[model samples]
Target: AQTVTQSQPEMSVQEAETVTLSCTYDTSENNYYLFWYKQPPSRQMILVIRQEAYKQQNATENRFSVNFQKAAKSFSLKISDSQLGDTAMYFCAFMKHAGNNNDMRFGAGTRLTVKP
Candidate 1:
């Protein structure tokens, strides 16, 4: 069974600062996908970033980036220039590759607050 772990339960960041959230996982599958999802107070999940196990290069999206360590089964997210809008519950997810199909399992989540 694959499980995602986000050690940090909560975090706070000042506006325009940067924050990094840690995530680790346990999986036996060699090929899979990692994702960081942000669920705002409204409860909509947004894909912050994604990384494939085969890709050594980390993924970045504007203000978000990830450090994906396949060997260690760790995937961490960094949010730069954090703003009030960045405040949300961040969930790390894992998806197994199934012949062009995929299903996701998420961590407990790290609730981030951006203090204005």
Candidate 2:
């Protein structure tokens, strides 16, 4: 069974600063995908970034990026030039590339508060 762990239950970042959220996972499958999903106050889960296990380069999207350490099974998200709108509950998710029933496992999530 695969599981994602987000050690931080809550995080705060000042506007215009950078914040990194820690995430670690346990999995034996060699081929899989890791994702960072952001759920704002509206409760919409937005795909922040995704990393393929086989890819050496990390995934990035605009002000969002991920530090993917496949060997250690560590995938963390970094938010640059954070804004108040970035505040949300962020979840780390995992799914096998094989797409078995399109099943995906999500972490408990970390509540991020962006302060002005």
Candidate 3:
């Protein structure tokens, strides 16, 4: 079994600034995937970035990047040049890379407010 945790329930960032959302996970499996998903007001879960356990390099998507620490089991999301559209409920998720089980564990979520 795997579990994801988001310590901060809410956060605010100024427009054109940067914000980092923290996430931690616990799992016994050696192979897995870590993800940061952004769900806007419309409630659509959009993938911000993803990281594989075996990959040492962190994943990045434009202004969105991840600080993945495999040893500490930490996968945090960094949003640069925050925009109004970035305001949403961000969720940290985990999934096993192998096996027939396709269950994904999600964090409680962190609601980010990008203020202009």
lDDT of 2 by residue, 5-81 (tens): 99999999999999999999998899888999999999989998998899999999999999999989999999999
Q: For candidate 1, lDDT tens digit of each residue in 1-116?
A: 88899999999999999999999999899888999999999999998899989999999999999998888889999999999999999999999987878878899999999999
The positional error of residue 65 in candidate 2, measured at the CA in angstroms, is: 0.6
Worst-scoring 10-residue span by lDDT in model 1? 96-105
The lDDT, on a scale of 0 to 1, for candidate 3 is: 0.94
Regions more than 4 Å wrong, model 2: none
Residue-level error in angstroms, candidate 3, position 97: 2.8
Which window of 10 residues has the lowest lDDT sum in candidate 2? 95-104
- Winner on lDDT (2 vs 3): 3
Clashing pairs in 3: none
Model 1 alpha-carbon miss at residue 38, Å:
0.6
Q: What's the distance in Å from true for residue 113, model 2?
A: 0.5
Which scores higher on TM-score, 1 or 3? 3
* Model 1: residues with Cα > 4 Å off, grouped in runs: none
After superposing candidate 3 on the true structure, give the runs of residues whose Cα lies further than 4 Å from its correct spot.
Answer: none
The residue pairs in collision within model 1 are: none
